[model samples]
Target: MRTIIENATLILPEGILKNGFAVCTDSIISQIGEGPFGKYNDSDMVIDAKGNYVSPGFIDMHTHGAGGHDFMDNTVEAYLGAARTHARYGTTSLVPTTLTSTTEELLNTFTIYEQAKEQNTDGADFLGLHLEGPYFAYNQRGAQDPEYLRNPEPEEYNLILAHGEKHIIRWSMAPELDGALELGRLLRSKGILASLGHTDALYEEVTEAYKNGFTHVTHLYSCMSTITRRNAYRYAGAVEATYMIDDMSVEIIADGIHLPKSLLQYVCKFKSIDNIALCTDSMRAAGMPDGEYILGSRDKGQVVVVEDGVAKLPDRSAFAGSVATADRLVRTMVEVAGISLSDAIKMITRNPARILGVDKTKGSLESGKDADIVIFDSDIAVQTTIVKGKVIYTQNNNLKS
Candidate 1:
């Protein structure tokens, strides 16, 4: 099937172009330009974009769960349910992240990815799995299970690599742990992204790890150490290393609660939109009203209640996860942080796509790229979300499909 979207304002790498027309043939975009359409046949389906903003679909690089479903459960339904909720919010691609768990549990979670990849739900495209635990510093475990936290083990790494079966795209770790650098090297050898997170490593350790192959940072300031003027040591903290390293990409939770609005603005000042990716780090409570929800597996701990956008544990620590969606993240960036709409969109779309190495297929609305696009009104509420040329979500007035 061929479809043509006419009379829309398209967002490109350079800037927004008014009065643009985009044509889609099956799953790939065929043409995008200004002016009259003379080459198309009469049978092609046409959608009047009505001057609305049309851009690449959002990509969530780090998300835990949604719709009362968690990836930690290691179930097919849980994965698909989370994907569906995110898709309705203009996210076309996402990585289902897992919390720290036992080796057996981690493998079980990896097996579920095969099922998610095989099934196509009417939600965001399941790009792959991101393992976010087990190799983290115990002090910065956040919501991860303390019992399961350990130093990197080559045997365990080999087991996961052997069974991952192409669905595992990234792994989050603490670089200061024993054998972590070697594990990072191994992950790089297998073409899997190694992300630094939940660490108390000095700046020198992080920089050395980056040289050894850690090219990404997970949830930049949440579980990482900050630099202080009093502790002017030889090694910089995670925060300092992140700012100094140009090649590394950093993920930030833009829900406003994780990091203060002022702090977020400061971080964005140093990190360009190209190197800073916006992630929800959302849990199962996302898209659901304020209520009780789980972060890690229920067996390891009880579910936390979400009150006023914070997911809190029993001890009353700040929410380790969030309820914000990708659409809301974009709006918050523009409305609160004072970032330009184009830069905010690039954080969710182009930046994440580039980090995941899927830019050619999923990043932008260019010809020959995948037809993953989102349409929204002036207020930025999602009106329609199309993935791979298929309309997965449509909103008409108060009604949704």
Candidate 2:
């Protein structure tokens, strides 16, 4: 099957191409060029972009759930349900993230993920799993359940690796905790991404953690320490170290609620578009109407409320999660943070794909790359989503066969 998208503004790695066209032969992009499109087979499925922007589909690296289903729901349906929901919002690739949970529950999720992935033909492709902690610090545990938070234990983590090594892509934890650096080393040895998150680590510890292979930061500026006083002596914290370090990549939940506009702009200014990726950090409430929901497994998760476009604890003490979608994140960065449309799209598409080590064929619009594309308008509203050359979701019925 051939899919052709023409007369659109293409977001390419170098820059935007006006009146560009892309030809997808099966799942791979066969050709891409600017100006008028050349001849094609009469049987080709051609889509006129109507002056909208055609770009690489978004890649979400740290999303927990969407469409009223969390990854920790421990069901195949829940996993695929969230993936499908994200796909509708321009996420062609996603890494299903887990919250702090029991070992048994984590193993169950691993089993379910394997099952769901086999049946995930109609949703966004699952890159892998991101284990977000049973290894975080207690005070920095934002919305993560405190019951499961603790220092890394070699025995328990090693057992987890034994069972879940193949499907685990990344793991986020507090690097300051006991045995955490060793855990980072173990993850690095296995080729899994080691990330710092939910921590109170100082600059020195963060520097050491980076050297030990913790090269990424999860949900930057959230659940991380800043400057603090230790015995009347002010010390730089993890947040400061993130800026001080030149090569460390970070993901931010650019939902406009979790982070204010000024802070988002500040991050973009310092981190640059290449080093910063955008994440939703969304919960089950994503794409759902404002209401009550669970943040993890139904039986053991905490109850949270979605209101004012963000999830929050019932007491309103802190943000439980975000209800933003991939499209919303791009829109927030462009409109709220004063970022250009091209750069904002990169944060959601190219940057995350690179951070997750899938940039060789997935991040941008190029010949011989996967046909994971999204068409959106000036407002960044996702009008069509094509995954692996298949028109998975379209707003105006633009698919032929």
Candidate 3:
């Protein structure tokens, strides 16, 4: 099938192109040019963008679940449902993430992920599985089950990796923990992304982590250390180390709530667009009404309340997770952090695709690339989402048959 989207402002890699058009042949982008497409036969599927911003579909590298279904729900239906929910908000590709859990639960998720992918239709394409951890610092393990948190165990991780090496794309953990450097090397050798998260590591530990293949920081500022005093001596923490490292990539939960405007601005001001990615870090309550919900698997997860646009523990002492969608993330960056639309879009698209090493085919709107596209208005409200040239979600039946 030939699909042409015309009369749009295309978000190209270099800059925005007004009155642009893109053509999709099968599942790949065949052409992108300025002005009208000139002629179209009845066989062609022409979509009028009405001057909306047509950009690469958002790629979320870290998201647990949405639409009342967590990936840890341990069912194919749950996986598909969450992906579908994010697609409606402009996510065309996403990595299904798992919270800290048992060895058995992690193994089961690996099996379930394989099953989910085989049946994933009408949803955002699954990039791969992101294991958020069974290894972390107890003091910094926010929202993660403390019962399962521990230092990296060579025997336990090696066993998990042996079974899941094929499906796992990335693993986040506290890099300062014992045996973490070895695990980082193992994951790197397997070409899996190793990232730092929920860590209380000092600058020196993070520097060592970088050499050991921990190239990314997960959810910067959230559950991560900043600066500390050790016997009246100030020491840099993971948060500060990220800025000094220069090449370290990081993802942030930019829900406006998880990070207030000032903190969001601070991150944007310090981090280059190429070195940053936006993630939802959302839970099952995303796209659902405010109320109580679970953070992981239905039976074993912790209970949290959803209100005030974010999820929190019942006592409201800490955030359990976010409820923001892909659109809200872009909106938060642009509207709250005062970032340009193009840069904010890049944080969710090209940056993540590059971080996950899938940039060659999925990140930008170029010919020969996957035709994963999203159309949104000035407000960053998603109007249509097309994954691999398939129009899965369109607002108000905007596209004609």
How well is each residue in 1-401 modelled by candidate 1, as lDDT tens digits?
Answer: 88787778888888998888888899899998986545667677677777888889999999998888888878888888988999899999999998877778878877777877688658789888898978988878888878788888888888887888487889999999999999889888888889999998888899999988899999989889776455564545998999899878999999888887897898889876689999999988899998777676655656788987768885676566888899988988888898999999999999999998899798888989999998876667887788998878876442211
Per-residue CA lDDT of model 2 for 215-316, tens digit only, reads 999999999999999899999999999999989999999999889999999998888679999999999999999989998889989999999999999999
- Name model 2 segments beyond 4 Å from true: none
Q: What C-alpha lDDT do the candidate models reach, one value each? A: 0.85, 0.92, 0.94
In model 1, which regions exceed 4 Å deviation? Answer: 36-42, 228-235, 396-401
Model 3 poorest 10 in a row by lDDT: 392-401
Predicted structure with the largest lDDT when compared to the true one: 3
- Please provide TM-scores, in order, for all candidate models, with all chains considered together: 0.95, 0.98, 0.98
Model 1: ten consecutive residues of lowest lDDT: 392-401
At residue 158, candidate 2 shows an lDDT of: 90
Q: What is the lDDT of residue 53 in candidate 3?
A: 97
How do all the candidates rank in terms of TM-score, highest first? Answer: 3, 2, 1
Look at candidate 2 and give me any clashing residue pairs. Answer: none
Whichever of 1 and 3 has more lDDT, that candidate is: 3
Q: Which candidate model has the greater lDDT, 1 or 2?
A: 2
RMSD of 2: 1.1
> What is the C-alpha lDDT profile of model 3 across 69-99, one tens digit per residue?
9999999999999999999999999999999
